[model samples]
Target: MKKILVIEDEEFVRENILELLDSEGLEVFGAENGRIGVDLAQQQQPDLILCDVMMPELDGYGVLTTLRQDSILATIPFIFLTAKAAKVDFRQGMELGADDYLTKPFTRAELLGAIASRLKKQEAVQEHYNTEIQQAKDRLSYLAHHDSLTELPNRLSLQELFKQVQPQDDNYQEVLAVLFVGLDRFSKINDNLGSDFGDSLLKAVAIRLKACVDDQDIVARINADQFTVILAKRNHKKDAADVAQSILTSISKIFVVAAQEVFITASIGLAFYRRDSIELQQLLSYAKKAMLQAKQQGGNQYQFYTATFHIISVDYLNLETSLRHALEREELVVYYQPQVDLKTGKISGAEALLRWHHPQRGIIKPDKFIPIAEETGLIIPIGEWVLQAACKQTKIWQDAGFHCLRVAVNLSGRQFSQIDLSQKILQILRETGFHPQHIDLELTESMLVSNTEVAIRRLKTLKSLGMQIAVDDFGTGYSSLSYLQEFPFDILKIDRCFVRNITANPHNAAITEAIIQIAKTLELKLIAEGVETEAELNFVCRHNCDLMQGYLFSEPVPPQEFEKLLFSGKNLQFSPKQDHEAKVR
Candidate 1:
């Protein structure tokens, strides 16, 4: 039942209004003045309030204003009771927020009609308010679990979904795979175009990714340029690979963004939930690592997380931790391997090699730690250390009368891509008091394949500084003769893989011979690596190779040992006894 309050200075009028409302089936209360009426309304929380215009303590307008200030009572219906029927008096009450008004000659029918109409209007407004409140709550809930820009489920939402579909109390086991897709070189596009264009491109990519998945699978935007698809009940690695390849092919197509045609590719990594127990984060991490490996191998491909990858990931984490402190602890040392003059049979130069002496693991080979350093970006600082140490050592040897020996330092892809690479190298030379001509920077062929123009520019700048540039591990990368012509490379070092079994394998011998001819045709000096036997050395010599470096000459030795060898003033002559001892060491 609805409750009503009637406030009037005249006791007769108050009683009449209360009785009329009570007879109409409303629970009615009466007050002699506006102040008492407000108190009664607050305490009883009546559905409607009928107040008088003129009263002691508080008038009808004052009562309405006071009630409006209280949140709980603000919306209650208010009406005025007045003796005057003047238009001006009615206007005053209405302007003061009156819901309805009753004059001196008002009938019972008029009073009931005003009360019923005001209550109906209040009910409508309350319903609208409740609906709006509910809608706002729903919007907030969605925003919490989804990406605001893409409107796709975010990492938190993905985690919650995983929890729902995870293996439960039943004996049946379920298999799932998480495919982490990363757009290769998306940042370049983002930078070339404006952020608005980049945002639109991401939206388009999201649409394509969603369309590629099944209804049962979940696709989420896990990062800025990365998306993840959770393939529940599909445990097979091949199924995940097929999906990844489809995604790669779809994204590799042309996309029109902001009226400009753009082409992009993606690298994907898949981690499966077979019978093994793994947390969501660990699985995601594994997929991420595999994706990065795909990117490192030149993107536009897919990789699956294998047992070997997991072991490597753990080792990578541990090695990254140790490498970060290697410089500070002085555990990194430079060893020099002689680059011999195969023609003159004299020591021509040395290559600076980095070796790590772990306190717990003894000496760690570069083959094991160098890749980890490169992946973790520890190579930047570590490469800088090698450059400085090599330059300083060369200057030391030059001062000690070994002026003919130049030192070569291998630059990783990350180091070679630095914007200030040439400047950094020049600064190191200046600080070490070494001539630029005596320091050679060896870069891999793969480094030049990604950004040929930028690589050419940087190489030109380094060449202009009087430093020699050599392509290390040649024939192992996807570079053709055209790249050799375009790049400002002074030497080409044949990869050790080809030279290791050149005599035993005719295929290896043919490739070596072809590489030597190509080097000669380009008029670029050739250096044969891993010449461990006399037959390999004689074959390289027969091909007129410019230099040879391997165990046949000398194993890489510490600075002190290298200095002793330099002081001997003797060229390395191949000896079976010395080669055996070097291999053992």
Candidate 2:
């Protein structure tokens, strides 16, 4: 029911107004003064407010001012009741956001008519607001399950959809294959070309990719440049490969962008569904590794993941099983890499990279198993483990009177896609009794190239928690300077590819210097990665680089080794000469 409020100071006039409104069957609330009327307006949130201009303690103007202060009530209809007939009086009410003004001694019929009209308009405004709210909610829900750029089902939706394709019995175990297709250097398209045009091209490509599949087949956008295809009826490796080739052909056609025709190639990797242990994440990992193999083989091709693949071996399978049990078994460890200040050569921060030690196979590299964990939806648990481990270690260091340093953790692309990643980070800090300033999230360049809006939002949310965000491997992907400005990134790590050649060629040296200058101008901290030699170190120092990390100091070690290094208070020294003929180590 719509409620109406009547505001009039005069007792006789107030009673009369209420009586007239009551006779019309309106749900009426009343106040004798403007101040009380404003309070009533807020409490009742009426459809319309009939207010008298001349009243003690906050008049009609004051009531309107109060209403306008609240965004929720700013658009409520307001009708003024006043005896003052001056143009100035009318102008003052309207300028104060009043909806209507009626002269005193007006007939009840006239008052009723004006009230009805304003009430009808208010109803329409509310209806429109409701409709927009519903539409926005629907879009958000859809975006959660679908890629915003291509409108294709996202990885989450794919996982849910794949569960339905599972085999019910071993006798009739349904066999299928998933092909993971990734665009080679897709980030370059978005960075070199404008984002607007890049988005349009992706939409067009999605349309073509979707068109190539049948109703029974499932196609989803899983990564920035990656798409996944579920071949429900294909059980054999050759059948899956044929389908993969067909998709490559469909996507190979020239894409028209801004009237400029461009041809791009795709790399595809295939993993048989049932053959890959019947786990959605495990299958995705195999497919991605195979896709990487295709990319490594010069792209524009497909590779079917098989037992011959090094990552799908018995050792790898055991490692995956061990990783799933690591958290429960309490077998995860964190190793810290020091961030050295170029000017003072002192440690400023440490990046906490995760490591796992298997009882039988010894220490396992993150590159080998982290993708499996992420694909298997084990990242959330693993990420939480990293956060808690890092925070607890930091707190222990603080208690030991070690230098106060920020510990950074690499955030996978899947981690950033979660709506609660930032909140979870903050919650971990609070629960662990750690300071927000002691942690940061390191994300790759591809994370930003996808949905920048979502990436920016997550960045801002993390920044608000007093945690920092860094772009890791800065130069390897599509590095956009404009994104550097728009998004809140506190650090930029120059890719090892660029840093490797800094000491040899004059052109690479100049490019490295330019990048340093750009980072300096943007007031972003710069870190040179893969610094293995003194010459590279000196070159980075000469350019006023903020930090350096590579074999020159030490390789990524175990937690005990890292702790020993930190406690030794030792400064690493190296020979300052390099062979001109020597290439990067």
The candidate that wins on lDDT is 1
lDDT (Cα, tens digit) per residue for candidate 2, span 1-585: 668899998989888888888888888878999888888887888888899998887988888988999877898899999999999999999998999989998998899999989988978987886675445334334534666558788876787789877666777544588889998777888898876777787788788877877788898988667889888775456776777888889888899988988777899998886667688889898999999889888999999887677644577677778888988887778888876666545556678888887777778888888988987888888988888888888777767777576688888878889888877887888888889887768898768756888788878888998887888987544454565678899988887867875777564565566567667757899998888787888788767777877777767666677677667764544334832211222
Worst ten in a row by lDDT for model 2: 576-585
* Distance from true location, Cα of 18 in model 1, Å: 2.1
lDDT of each: 0.82, 0.78
TM-score of each: 0.51, 0.53
Q: What is the TM-score of candidate 1?
A: 0.51
Q: Tell me the deviation in Å of residue 21 in model 2.
A: 2.0
Instruction: Report the Cα lDDT for residue 172, model 1.
Output: 47
Candidate 1, residue 455: CA error in Å? 55
Q: For candidate 1, what is the lDDT?
A: 0.82
